[model samples]
Target: MTDTLIKVDLSQSAYDNDMIHNRWHPDIPMVAWVRPGDDFIVECVDWTGGQIKNDDDASDVRDVDLSQVHFLSGPIGVKGAEPGDLLVVDFLDIGAFSDSLWGFNGFFSKKNGGGFLTEHFPEAQKSIWDIKGMFTSSRHIPGVNFAGLIHPGLIGCLPSKEMLNTWNTREAELYNTDPDRVPALATLPYGPTAHMGRMQGDAAKSAAAEGARTVPPREHGGNCDIKDLSRGAKVFFPVYVDGGGLSMGDLHFSQGDGEITFCGAIEMAGWIHLKVSLIKGGMAKYGVKNPIFKPSPITPTYNDYLIFEGISVDEGGKQHYLDVHIAYRQACLNAIEYLKKFGYSGAQAYAILGTAPVQGHISGVVDIPNACATLWLPTEIFEFSIQPGADGPTIFDTKGIDVPLAKDL
Candidate 1:
């Protein structure tokens, strides 16, 4: 039988909200029926959902309402999707409809009160630029290549009532106990005062107000805009509710590593065409429970441990750099301990791992953690092999011997 797929248009009329959530309305009917392994195309409206016509200024950013800003398309139910299956979403293609502009005022930017840069620059300038030619103009510093990467900013499932209420009530109590905590919770545009008061009444009762949906996950799915999850990469997500209730939003054109500022290289909207498939009993097939699972192997063949040492040197005549020296020593010790976990002799591991492992250095300026190091393991040394009957081996159980073969090793 031929593969069945569906086509959705975010610009269509079937969606409920006209604001953020409506940009990629989920109410539209399927273009066609679909099953596992089917490929489909989806046409998306820009984040504005066609509300802000051309000639809109960057200040238009303020016009977006928080409640309706992040409109997503659909919870496209996957056929035969059970609570125990795995959904393998391959990002086949992503492109923008037109040139767009995303400035430093949105949720992802640090200009906001709760952002990472808030303390660094209490009063900072708002940066804005034209994204019309972003695809061609935007480039990684010192690198000649134009940027190209795609990741979803929002993707998740409907949560149960218990989970929803627990979060709401917790927030309310926290706010009431300490009003200063309000700034910490300002990541989004929700009405802070109203939320705090509502939470105070009855945390559990307030949970009944609205079901929770779209929580971020680090387990391997949903709003994990990891730069590595790009074209040609395979991602595995565990199925929770029936059909997995899958949806995708916050399509980013490109982003940097760590997503430090939380903003991507470019935030724009367009059509994202992809293929979806299922591995029947895939979750159990791979020993994963949650829909999100890490792609790395627990006991990798080659590994590197990283440590960062931040040193502050006082330029006064005394010449003190104690903090820097301590940080460096701590990093070295961390690396040694990390290598020992993989069956390396202290001296050998330090010598070999230090030379072979990938290293990264960064400068930490005023009011920020600085001077960091990263250890990278080459994928070639250790290959991911699935064992049908075992949870895999532990480094301690191995008694300090490296497993040579991926399977028996």
Candidate 2:
């Protein structure tokens, strides 16, 4: 039989709900599983279900009940998918409703209150801004890639009853804060120092009042907005509940790393096509929780590590370069150690890793005190083996030192 493509109609009232607060109910029809080579397309509704039109403005955005903004479709069942299996969602394509561009002051703008720059530009605010016309040309370049790419910012299945409630409460508290104070308050580090203590207390009280919604990351994945979860990317999610309780929202058009705005790209309408497959008998082994990871295979090599500094630039153009270089170096070191656990010799690991290690800058500066950098080894380096013990670790062996190739899930 030809693989079937499931069409989920978001236009139905049963699927309509507030984007921010709704969770995928198991009752929604789910897409079934197919073999590795099977293919299909799934239709999705705009985050607003077309209720908010193309011409809607800042007033429309402001008046939106925070809960009902980002509606998504599906919890499509993958037939034969059990609790321990992994749902491999291959994103084949994504298309937006139309080419019309739109932009508004984001959650970080002064008026909306709360961003890394709030302290520096205490008065910088925009009530009704248009980002459609802004464009820049490079000195050596001849053209501009119209900035737009849609992907969800928050996508994952709910963890547990308590965790979902906590996430909801936190979001509510964040929404109720004075737009001005929100930015600063949200960025404050949790601690016992006077300022941190006070902020934590207030946040705690706010969360409690808002019904204690929380989202914690664990073996059962919660809110991980890894930007790579886009078209052409394959995400392997472990099933927790019987139907997996899959849900996705927080649409972004284009966003830099670190999603400094705590928001991403354009929040608009689009549909994502996914194919679900079962990874039989794969569960959290080695105490590993959250059975999700980018499936890009990396080869081992030894070479000088590339490094980049992550810095936040203020509206006044001030630059805050945190010790990003140190962070980058440490991350590389950590990778080496992690590989050692897999049983590869230090020299072999370093040599294989050095083949191509690129340093990446995560936009931590966009939000104060949330700095991050990444070191990555290219997936092309690993040579895949066929016979199990012929040469290298088994594909399933993500542990051990001195080798490469992640086991196919």
What's the TM-score of every candidate structure? 0.54, 0.50
Cα lDDT tens digits for candidate 1, 270-359:
656666788778878789844542321212133332333424432232333334433333444454465555444343233222222233
State how far residue 119 of model 2 sits from its true place (Å).
4.1
lDDT of each: 0.41, 0.40
What TM-score does model 1 achieve against the real structure? 0.54
- Judge candidate 2 at residue 81 and give its lDDT: 59
RMSD of 1: 16.5
Model 2, 1-409: lDDT tens digits are 4332434344454233222223332233343434444565544454444443334232343233333333444444455656666766676655543443442223233444333333432332211112243221111111112223345555554344454354555655765585354433332212221111111245533432332111223344434545456666667777755656555654444444343322223444445665556676566442334646653232123243323332333334454455454454445455545554444434333322222223245435345543565655433223432222445544324343221211211
